[model samples]
Target chain A: MKKWVPTVIFLAVAVVLIVLAIVFLPVSKSVWVWIAALLTLAIFSILYRDNPIYRIAEHIFVGLSLGYGLAMIWHLALWQIALRPLFVEGRFILIIPIAIGLLYFTRLIPKVSWLVRIPISIALGLGSGIAIPLIFQATIFEQTKASLVLPEMFAPGNPWPGIWAIILIIGIVTTLAYFFFSRKEKSVLSPVSKVGIIFIMLGFGATFGLTVMSRVSLLIGRVQFLLREWLGIIAQ
Target chain B: MKRRIPLTLTLVLGIVMMIQFFIPHQFSQDFKNTALEWLRVIGGFAFIIGLASFITHHYTKIKHKKEGWAYSPIALGALVVMAVVGLIGRSPNMNWIPVTVQGQQISVFTYLFSNFFTHMMIPLGATMFSVLAFYIASAAYRSFRAKSLVSILLLVAAFVIMLAIIFYNVLPLGDLGEWLLSVPNMAAKRGILLGASLGGIATSLKIILGIERGYLGGTK
Candidate 1:
C-alpha cells in the first residue's frame, strides 16, 4: 500500500506530462526533451542511495547505448569506412583495416577467439608509433621552448625588466628540478625546488573549482524539476 | 554466441579505433567519425536505462519495507510523473490533453526541463562540488607538515600558488602571480603532462590490444 501510493501518484503525473507533451511539442522534440530531463535526475539520484530502480535504469541505458553504438558502426564503419572505399572509390588498400575490424568478431567463436589479437596488435603498434612523437612535439618541445627562450627586452635601455626575465628563468629551472625523484639536492637547490611545489597546487585548485561547478549545475536541475514540474505552482 | 560475439566485436572495433588515428586513410577517418557517433547514440540510450534502473531499484526497496524504503515512493513518483508528461505532451492531433494555448504552445515538461533542469540541477551540482573546499582546507591543515625536503617543496609551492592567485590584483603581487603562472608553474605542469601522456598512451595501447581486460570484467 505504501509502495502503491507513490507509484500511483507517479503514474498519474506521468500521464499528465505525456498528454501535455504530445499535444504541445513537435512529435520529434517532445519525447526526447522530457526523456533527457528525467534521465539526468535519475542518474544524479545515485548519490543518495543505491537501489533496484537505479540498476534497472542503468541496464536499460547500457542496452540502449549498445544498440545505438551498433547502429552507428553500421552506418559509419560498414558503409563509410569499409564499404564506400571498397566499392565506390575502388580503394582496394582499404581491405586491410576492414579485414582487421572483421576479425574482432572472431571472439564469438570459442576456439578461434585468439585470432582477434593479430589485428589488435597492429592497431596498437601503429597508434603508439604515431602518437608518441606527436605528443613530444606539441607538449614537451613546444611548451619548454617557449618558456626557455625570451623575447629581446621591449625597452633595451631598461635593466629592471631583464632582471624579471632572469628571475623567471631561474624559477622555471628550479621548478623542473623539483620534480626529479632520484636526485639528491644539496643546499640552495633545495629551496628553489620548494618554490616549485607551490605552483603545482594552484593549478590543481582551479581544476577542482571547475569540476565543482559542473556538479552544482546538475543538482540545480533536479530541484527545479521538483518545484516546477510536480507542484505545477510555477506557470510555463 | 552472445558472449563470444560481443567480445570479438568490442575487440575489433576498439582496435580499429586506435589504428585509424595513425593510418589517416578515408576508411580510418570514417571509422573514427562513426565510432564517435556510435558513442553518442549509446550515451543517449544509456540515459533511459538509467531512468528505468532508478524506478526499479527504488520500487523494490519500498516493497520490501527496508530501512529508508519510504523514500522510494518519492523517487518512483518523480520518475513516473516525469516520464508520463514527457510522453503524453508530445503528440500533434487534438491529443488527449491540450497542454498549450493557441500561439504560446507550452506544457508541464517544457516548464520542467527548461526552468527546472537547467536552473536547479546545474547549480546544485556546482554547490555539491564546492563542498570540496572545506574538505581540502581541513585535509591540508592536518597533513601539511614541513618535515622533509619533498614535503617542504610541496608546502612552499602550495603557499606561493595560493598567495599569487589570491593577491593577484595588487601591484607587484599581480606581476608575481603572472610570472608564477607563466614560468615555473607552466614548467611543472608540462612535466606532469608529459608523464601523464606517457601513461595514457600505454593504457590506450593496452586496452586496444585486449591486454587490459579488466575493463572487460575481471580475471575470467
Candidate 2:
C-alpha cells in the first residue's frame, strides 16, 4: 500500500496532466494559463515544508519539464542536425561534430574517460582564445582610455579637481599592484598595495548595502501578496 | 556495452561541440544547438530523479509516523490534486464543462498558486535573503575598526560614501564617492576579472583534456 498507492495516484495524475498539456492547453487561453500558474504554486510549496503532495507535484514538474525539453529538441534539432545536414548534404564536416559529440557519452564507460579530453581540450582552447583578447580590450585599454587627461582644463575648471585626479591615479596604480600575485613586493608597490586594500573594503561595503535593498524589495513582494491576496486586506 | 557505447559517443560529441563554436559554418551552429538540447533533456531527467526521491522520502516518513507527519496528508493531497488538475486541463477532448463548472479546475489551480504559492513562497525566500542586511549592519559595526593607516583610509572612504547617500548637504563629498567607485574600484575590479578569467580558462582546459575527471564522478 505504501509504495503502490502513491505510484498509482501519481501515474493517474501524470497521465491527466500530459493529456491536458498536449491537447487542451492550446485551446483555452484563460483556463490553461491558470493551470500553469497553479502548477508553479504547487511546486513552490516545498519552500514552506516537504510532504507527499509537494513531492508528487515536484516529481510531475520534473517529468513534464524533461518531457517538454526532449520534445522541443527532437522537433527543432534532430531533423536539421542528423538528417538534413549530414544525411542529406553528405557534408564531410558533419562527421567531425558527430565524433566530438560522441566523446561526451564516454563517461558512462569505465575505461574511456581519457577519450573525453579530446573534445574538452578544443572547447577550453577556443573559450580562452576568445576571452583573452576580449579581456584586454574591455579591461586594460578601456580603463586606460577613461583615465586619460589633458594638461589644460576647461575655462571654469578648478585645480582642486585635477589634484584629486592625481590622488585617484595613485590609488588605481597601487590597488592594481596589490593583486600582482606572482612576484614578491618589497619596493614602493608594497605600501601602494596596502592603499589598494583600503579601496577594496569601501567598495565591498557599498555593494553589501545595495544587496540589502534588493532583498527588502523581495520581502515586500511576498508580504504584499499574503496580506492583499490571501487575507484580502492590506494597507496601501 | 552500455558504458563503451556511451563513452565513445561522448568523446566524439564533445570534440564536435568544441569545434562547432569556431567553425563559422551553418552545420556547426546546428550541431551546437543540438548538443545544448540534449544537455537540457539530460537535465530534465535529473529533476525526475529528484521527484522520485521526494516521494520515497515522504512516504517513509508518513508510514513510520515520524514527528510532524500529519502535514504529509495535506502535502500529498495538494500534489495529487495538482496532478489531476494538470492532467484534466491537458486533455483537449475532455470537454471544458467539467473543468469550468464541476471542479472549476482552472480557477481552483490559479487560486491555489496565487493565494498560497506566490504569496507565501516568494516572500519567505525574500525574507530569508533580507536577513543578510541586519547581519551586514552588525558586522560593519563590530569589524570596520581602524587601527592603522590602511584601515583609516578605508574608514574615511566608507564614511564619505555613506554620508553622500544619506545627507544632501554633502554635495562636495559626492565627488569623493564617485572617485572611489570609478577609479580605484575599476582598477581592482579589472584585476579580479583578469584572475577569474585565467582560472576559468584553466578549468575549461582541464575539463577538455580529461585532466578534470571530477565532473564525471571519479573516473566512472
C-alpha displacement of A7 in model 1, angstroms? 28
A144-213 per-residue lDDT for model 1 (tens digits): 6755535564367776555655555555566566665566758556777676665455444433333434
RMSD after Cα superposition, model 1: 10.4
| Candidate with maximal DockQ | 2
Error of 2 at A225 (Å): 6.8
Candidate 1 chain B, poorest ten consecutive residues by summed lDDT: B85-94
Which tens-of-lDDT digit does each residue in A57-158 have in candidate 2?
554443333333333343344434543576779865556655664565564475776555544444443444444445456755776666555565322657
Candidate 1 residue lDDT tens string, B1-220: 4234434555565555555667858986776665543343333333444454555676788788987665556545544444444333332332453256456666655445343334333433343453344456667778778787655655655665556556667677667556555655555566577557656667765655556654333323
TM-score of each: 0.52, 0.55
> What is residue A115's positional error in candidate 2, in angstroms?
14
Q: Residue A72 of candidate 2: its Cα lDDT?
A: 38
